[model samples]
Target: MRIFNEFTFEAAHHLPHIFPDGHINTRLHGHSFRVRVTLEGKPDGKTGLISDLGTVKAAFDSAHEKLDHRYLNEVDGLETPTLENISMWLWRHFARSLSGLAQVGVYRDTCGEGCEYAGEYEIERKAA
Candidate 1:
């Protein structure tokens, strides 16, 4: 069985790497970012549910608190802040607690454009 939850956060970001080319992404912009967290696992016999919605929501809430109303480029793991990077950052952030986590989807807005990270590949992080 699989379960999913959605959360929204507002933040600003600019792609530094895209600046030299004068891409629009180089200018600071904000989005009502939407995140979908998907978890896959067999249902528990007692509860007959894959996971508790409240528990999953609370975990996402804690993670979203750090991103909401902030500048994405300033966040610890999101200095570059592309859709792909943001999704991967979220996957790492919630995977430990949500062991069954299968994927993370990040929507730039209500638009269909976004990115999904399935945790199928390793992302090297810069040393702090």
Candidate 2:
């Protein structure tokens, strides 16, 4: 069975390397970032559910609190704070607590600009 949850947070960031030539991103900016977490595993026979929705929500809420209404560039490990990096950071944050964590999708907004991270193995392969 596979279960998914969605979360949203607002944060400010600036990509200094994206467009250094007087681009708008060079200055501080904010976005309503959305994230989706997917978990894959066999449902427990007793509960018939992959996981409890409230439990998952609590986990996401705890993590999102760190990002919400904050400056992404000031967050540790988020100095660059691109969509890709943010997704990866989220994956790492939840992997240990969420069993069978499969993927994390991070979006800048509703316009479909975002990135998805599968796991550390896949990320390592891409780097290689």
All models: lDDT?
Answer: 0.87, 0.84
**True lDDT of residue 106, candidate 2:** 92
Best by TM-score: 1
- Deviating ranges (above 4 Å) for candidate 1: 19-21, 125-128
lDDT tens digits, residues 55-87, model 1?
778888878888999998889988988889899
RMSD of each: 1.9, 3.2
**Model 2 RMSD, rounded to 1 decimal:** 3.2
Stretch of 10 with least lDDT, candidate 1: 16-25
lDDT of residue 11 for candidate 2: 87
Per-prediction TM-score to the true structure, in the order listed: 0.90, 0.88
Off by over 4 Å in 2: 121-128
Candidate 1 residue 85 Cα shift, in angstroms, is 0.7
What shift in Å separates residue 8 of candidate 1 from its native position after superposition? 0.5
Clashes of each: 0, 0
